[model samples]
Target: MKFLTHTSIAFILLLFASTSYSARIKDIASIQGVRSNQLVGYGLVVGLPGTGEKSSKFTEQAFSTMLRNFGVNIPIGEKLKIKNVAPVAVTAELKAFAKRGQKIDITVSAIGEAKSLRGGELLQTFLKGVDGKIYAIAQGSVVVGGLGAEGADGSKVMINTPTVGRIANGAMVEKEVISPFSQGDTITFNLYESDFTTAKRMADTINNLVGANTATMLDATSVQVLAPRNISQRVSYLSTLENLEFEPARGAAKVIVNSRTGTIVIGQDVKLLPTAITHGGISVTISENKTVDQPNAFAGGKTQVTNNSTITITNEDSRMFTFDTGVSLNDLVRAVNEVGLAPGDLMAILEALKQAGALQGELIII
Candidate 1:
């Protein structure tokens, strides 16, 4: 089968210029101090159907510790047959401004050599933050989305991950991490993507809405805006401010190429200088045939096999094309389609242009 060229299989996205569009401040930026915190803890899962760890020291020690806390002690050097319990690591994300007694979801993952946690129940575990302070307590029946089965002949089949599970609203917040949002005189809005033009435009937009000097552009990422010191008024003020719409700067010129999938995307702003390029490929084909040689009747001669091979080579006609100075993306695509170049050839041409300083944009290959 003949391979398809770029003109046949490649996807070209051409973004044409249109009317200016605006985006809401909340869609492009976020409050600096409003973010989620990661919390983790070590615990155990119980009530497994004989799929738990059998000889893990940590699992046994954790089991022993729990029993000791319950006013029971195990005799020294006595191995416990606790195959119903498995040690696990519990994790949860504590969102900002989470109040005490609020329920949050938690994930339980086995840390030992347990076969599965399909029907396990996580014990009470204290989830802590980076500062080593307990933030929430987790305890619930695990819900596993995976299934596992083992045969007596040492064959096993599994889907998803049986050793990991999640419990919805299983953890209750026990502490609150203080935030500086209500304590500061000014609030900062940080852009998700840093751009000096976007930052300046945001400041200008705010100043136009709430009068001069209301917002200040600090850098490429942050825009500090003056607000009421009172928490209630500040909340209302930010609510109004974040919903305002304004035009942000366009992204920089870039060309992205997926090497594995042969997908090439050229940004609208990408420009090309005056340059000439030519591309072609050579195709080689080979074939073989076999035949048998038989002796005549009563001749007593042995039969032998004969083989024949044939090879053919074909070369594509190379074509040279020129791009004028300050060429747009549309022109580049039109020329490539007219020449019927494949995606691989186009990628090579783009890289060569970049090396020769003819491409006026960034080229990224993934």
Candidate 2:
């Protein structure tokens, strides 16, 4: 645990040192209203080999409807035993300014009792946006990366997810989503992680490059900058602005503890106030034994058995440490390493410190 702690801290320090904790505008923020939109629709996947849904009512109804649309009539109340088709949900992302005939990838997921979607083909499906408007048409052969097989005795071997598949360049866009970026006189940059200081620094960086009062900090998350109305000039202007480098403000002091994996991450700014902490452990053990009495067999013509139990307890020597006012991360690490505490023990101590108002950072356990 001590080695792991030291290694994590060293890696963090190396990362900060390598980049000087600076980031480009393109990496930290995004152009507002210039993002991808989600599209979804119900579709069907076919051409499976005895691995499709058998008893799903929705799959049957959908299959019948498709057949009817193709001029085939089926008698009412007749169940079709189709074993090569499965109902699926298709999803895709429509990028901003996507033109007609542009191809995009799509994901197909089984929504029935299908055993596998391998070697299946998705039929022509309409991918609709949130407003229920068709934006693209999807139809392609599914490329499955998972494998699945089932035995007659109900045993099955599966790897990854057998019911989901993807098709690259499967959907062709048929409509363009209107964006407000070209309509407004100013383009807004939205920070991925909002910080007031970072916003001010970003605005200042842009103002220095373009001219004074060119970029205005609208809020902690948004920075509005004036731009040309022409699309070509606007595009060139954004290309230059996004590449500009600036130093983002440091994040707040925080300690994150992953309870499941026993991972503790302490930020560089995390400090400890004046306090004392002691940690120890106690363990208990119990054992059971059985014995037989032979004297009862001779006197009463019967033998009896009795049960016995043993209990033991052990405790380790308690270790205590004190922290002065405004102790830094290095000092805390040194003290914890000297005390030989495991990750779980360290987590307990951190929680105790937070409760006692001695930790000068937010302690988050996940």
Candidate 3:
């Protein structure tokens, strides 16, 4: 038993040690100007089994336009009863430096009152960027993550979202987006989360790996690194820089409370000042009793209705506790748990502590 216990303890410690180490630069920051662009377009979905939108003027107009493009013209004011088709808005993210003819995935969402998008195929659509320039053409069968079925009695069952679907590798790039990666002798790295300590540490690590004065911290969110003037050498330099690993600085102490879900999260650096706390609850209950008042048999009075009401208030006994100076997060959690407080009560207590200057951390309620 002793041996097994010792082995278990060692395994847990090893796991923690492995996860507490430094992270790679590539995982913490991204090179500036190397990001994806959003593209969107209006399209139509077909092949739905009577589940498509009905009486949609936009869908009808779009269908007419498509037919006219195919050299089939319909008369003016002609209404088409196309219940198997739906108008959809298609969107995709064009990755940086995507070459022409590269295939990308696209998302199609119903723009009408469609019942479901299952078993639908998106027609050929031109996806455009924010500049109104056509970037790619998307067309393929959609794969919906949800399904639905309705009975003749108006009862329906659904799973997930039925109005949205995806098409893997449905868009083929028609144009290439130019990047300025090789234009300058320096490249900037933007941190995912802006922090002065993290920015400084990253700069120092890069400087130590490459050379002195090779990297500089521009601000809490950006770090500039000198690179080779040659494009080939710059690629190699960035590859090496991204693989470097270093420990990041700890973040500020904070407590996050979710009011709707009654969830509370405390940071490791959270501390409590020397203070005393007491917790209790008050409950008010109101009850009503209905009865009938009857007159005596010989009296000529009619029976009357009456109501009896009662109100009660109860206050629970509170327990008092004190915390030493610089109480750790674990100690605070343990003490609170020992008092058997719910998350809602814990939120109230934390707010009170913050107001009284007893909490040494920022309290954020969402």
The lDDT, on a scale of 0 to 1, for candidate 1 is 0.90
lDDT of each candidate versus the true structure: 0.90, 0.90, 0.88
The residue-by-residue lDDT of candidate 1 on 167-253, one tens digit each, is 999999999999889977899999999999999999999999999999998999999999999999999999999999998898899
C-alpha TM-scores of all predictions: 0.87, 0.90, 0.88
Ranking by TM-score: 2, 3, 1
The candidate maximizing TM-score is: 2
lDDT (10s digit) by residue, model 3, range 1-366: 333343344334534543557989999999999989999999999999998989877788899999999999999988898789999999999999999999999999998989898999999999999899999999999999988888999999999989999999999999888888888889999999899999999999999888999999999999999998899999998999999999987778888988997767777778899999999968999999999999999999999889999999999988888999999775776677567677777799999999999999899999
Candidate 1, residue 272: Cα displacement in angstroms equals 1.0
Off by over 4 Å in 2: 1-19, 282-313
lDDT of residue 126 for candidate 2 = 95
User: For candidate 2, lDDT tens digit of each residue in 106-220?
Assistant: 9999988898999999999999999999999999999999999889999989999989999999999998999988987999999999999999999999999999989999999
Clash totals for all candidate models: 0, 0, 0
Question: Which regions in candidate 3 have their CA more than 4 angstroms from the true location?
Answer: 1-20, 282-317
Quick one: ranking by lDDT, best first?
2, 1, 3
Clashing pairs in 1: none
